[model samples]
Target: TQGDSGIQRKGIILGKELARSLGAYTGDLLAMMSPSVRMTPLGIIPKIKMVEVVGIFESKMYEYDSNLAFISLSSAQSLFGMKNRVSGIEIKVDDIDAAGHIAVVIQKKLGAPYFARGWMQMNKNLFSALKLEKITMFIILILIILVAAFNIISTLFMVVMDKAKDIAILKSMGATRASIMKIFSMQGLIIGVCGTALGCLAGFTIVPNLNKIVGFIEQLFDIEAFPSDVYYLDELPSQIQYFDSFLIIVFSILICFLASLYPAWRASRLDPVEGLRYE
Candidate 1:
């Protein structure tokens, strides 16, 4: 409707990017060829048909936008010389996670010569690569948090030494060793908890807007960070997994707890006499 007044019986709708690449627009004629061949006077030749461009569409994925096209079912069948037969039909399911199962069911029902493939199967490699990237990023994050935990450990040890005289005075005042240990352990754990909370706050606030942030930087610098053609994407998209975030936070907190242990134990073991004598 946006292009030609109407889609004629033999008209086609080209993808936006595809039309741009072909320098074609509304009401333009395009020659479509099919692998099906016919015996000609000279030799066998591929079948070809000239069809009017009726409209254009976009799917966000550069791979689809740059290569996909749409035509009438009858027109496609005629082009392939498949008379009354179709290559395939696309079915959309409400739940994407059940796609593979539905595909199997369809395949079983269709029986011989007919098979079904889900979107996941069609794009397996891409998803696998994405999973690997997630894993690598997670590992890197853990390493960074581990380094911070070591810093916390060092800081707590320093606190224990700095407060040695105070511990001696507390012991003389009839304070229990467990209470002293609890004080140092809590100091380290509290530091870790606060840092984790702040990091989560920043990550949640920023990660969702990464696309806009990157776009601004690119515009400011006159640079292209993610080239559309190269990445097969019109723009970058990000999704946050709450479960993964929860796991990371829990692990970081555990690391902090572990880092607090040695220092707390050493503080509890301090000899009040030695501490007072040194003072």
Candidate 2:
């Protein structure tokens, strides 16, 4: 997080871990070596320069904090024997998902040696794994929804069995079969709607605080959920997609509606005289 002084000629800003390992701090001088070797009068030796430590930064990411450094473009160019040019440039865009398309457009517009590489291309494997994880999670959610739908079906069947005589009486009183079906179907829809609403409410309440929840679990169990060396992130991150939520609601209600049909049809087809006699 350190920054105020500029990285000037032979001045470098180092990662905190790097600084700690070297016991170097601001205003300290250190020798920086270039990988390329130059033919010296004595022998072939690597180019080296005395660089001043301008600042030390902490990023909380192990790879960056341990291995990264910052220097002025001119100093870097001179040190690397690039004279006046840089090998690459980094550009940030608003929509990361459209990065590949944007990169293609950039390449088309600025032809020749100019090229563009997006974050997606740079981290393709990571995103692919994340996409697979998302698919698996959705599959599990669908299975859970199906189990809930089965519960609704079993509950409605029990209700139908308990209310057989009432249903028979209603039939005798000239209630239409469709009317009976609608009543039971509406009941199932209500159950589905309530359950979905509660689930969504809980999700909304929990998601924003998920990191805190994970932290608590980690502390209680003495475990590391996001070890710095193992995971790229320091904590869990969550984003709620409204479209996905809407789709889940629709799917759940449709399943419940379908589950209600068989029980309602059975109730509709019961013989009034037999139902009454059995009761």
Candidate 3:
């Protein structure tokens, strides 16, 4: 790690094999310079120095691949001439979900000198836009379920028309108007449960291997892999919360129940004399 004042080169950190791969090893001199550019009367001067490699470290991320150099905090601070001052500090919370509350607690604990931010707050704009897009996509996808519910409505309405005489006979036999409603409601519930279950199953089956599926499609279609740069994530991310799944199932059932209303009411209002006479 290089800083403004000078550099700290030799630090025994990484082991032998890694150092050899990086073309660096213990006792090898490494040079580092401060990031600051000073405009003197003569010209812009950059502070620079060299250090002997004592150790090396690696982080799995591509951003840190082959580029990160480790140095002592004291060396960094002195080199930058930032006496007792740091550009920023990183904090990690035990539970990521509680980051917002933790950040607030930290701010309060530390009082006025420092400001704290959570990961979500730091990425608020990006996450907010993603949330909006996801909601819109959900609404659009739900139309598929709604359309399926309409199919239930159409099928039951036909059954009502075909069984009008039976329904009338039931009504005359002391099966109250509400009982007639229950019959059709049960039919609609069956269809809704079947369709929602199938849809949920299909979603789960596809989501787990979505990346592999996309890779195959890209190869077959002769297109590039999905754009990782734009998306920031390497693969599609799907977080399946059981609660969310339950909400979807409940919502689909409601759509189906509501769809049954008009047709069921029509069946309940029919007169036994008129229905049987027509038959």
Candidate 4:
């Protein structure tokens, strides 16, 4: 385990991306300089010291991976001439989900002159952007469901046109108008249910293997489809949330049900006398 300053007497830990960029490895010496100047006999000069690289940390985020470096608290304090003070405190909580609440508590306890901030509050903008992107994608993906609903609507209309005589016969034989409506509605519901099931099946089957699928495509095309340098990620990321999936399925079914309403109503309103006359 390493401390806040990240400096050790033996060496220092550098961010993985920074180390890679510098072509440095363990045991390699890295010179660090402070902007603060020290007085010398000749003139003022920036303070500089060389330290060995002991380890590298991978944070996965490009911003942190490329920029952050760690040194020990004693080394940092000595180098910066800060005797017994720290800029901030880092706290780890048992439940990450309660970080916001905990931060508030800490802030209250610390009171004026000091404030506690959670990672969520610190990175609120980035998370907000991600949330917005997710919502936009959700809206765009919903078009596919709307298209499927349209298909259901057209199919139900065609079925009702074809079965007009049968519907009229059923109505004359004691089936109520509401029952006729339900029959077509159920037909549409069955189509929607089957479609939703197949979609969920395909999603579950493919999402887990999406990385492999991308790799195959890249190999087939002899191209780097997602370059790590450009994307800042070695591989694609995929997450499956059951609640999100359930919401999508429910929304799709609701759209399908709404689409079926007009067609089913039309089917129920067909005059039995006219339908029988044509037959």
Which regions of candidate 4 fall more than 4 Å away from where they truly are? 1-7, 168-175, 222-232, 276-279
lDDT of each: 0.89, 0.87, 0.75, 0.85
Quote each prediction's TM-score: 0.91, 0.86, 0.70, 0.86
lDDT of 4 by residue, 1-279 (tens): 222234567478887788889998887898888777899999999988788888888877667777888888877877787878887879899999899999999889989999888889998997898899999999887988889888998999899888989988998998988999998898888888888899999999999999999999999999988776677676889989999999999998888888899999999899999778867
Question: Candidate 2, residues 28-63: lDDT per residue as tens digits?
Answer: 999999998899799999999899888888887767
TM-score: model 4 vs. ground truth = 0.86
* Candidate structures ordered by TM-score, highest first: 1, 4, 2, 3
Give the clash total for candidate 4: 5
Residue 184's C-alpha lDDT in candidate 1? 86
Task: Encode model 1's per-residue lDDT on 60-113: one tens digit a residue.
Answer: 778988888888888998998989998788999999999999999999999989
Angstrom error of the Cα, residue 75, model 3: value is 5.3
Ranking by lDDT: 1, 2, 4, 3
TM-score of the candidate numbered 2? 0.86
C-alpha-based local distance difference test score of model 3: 0.75
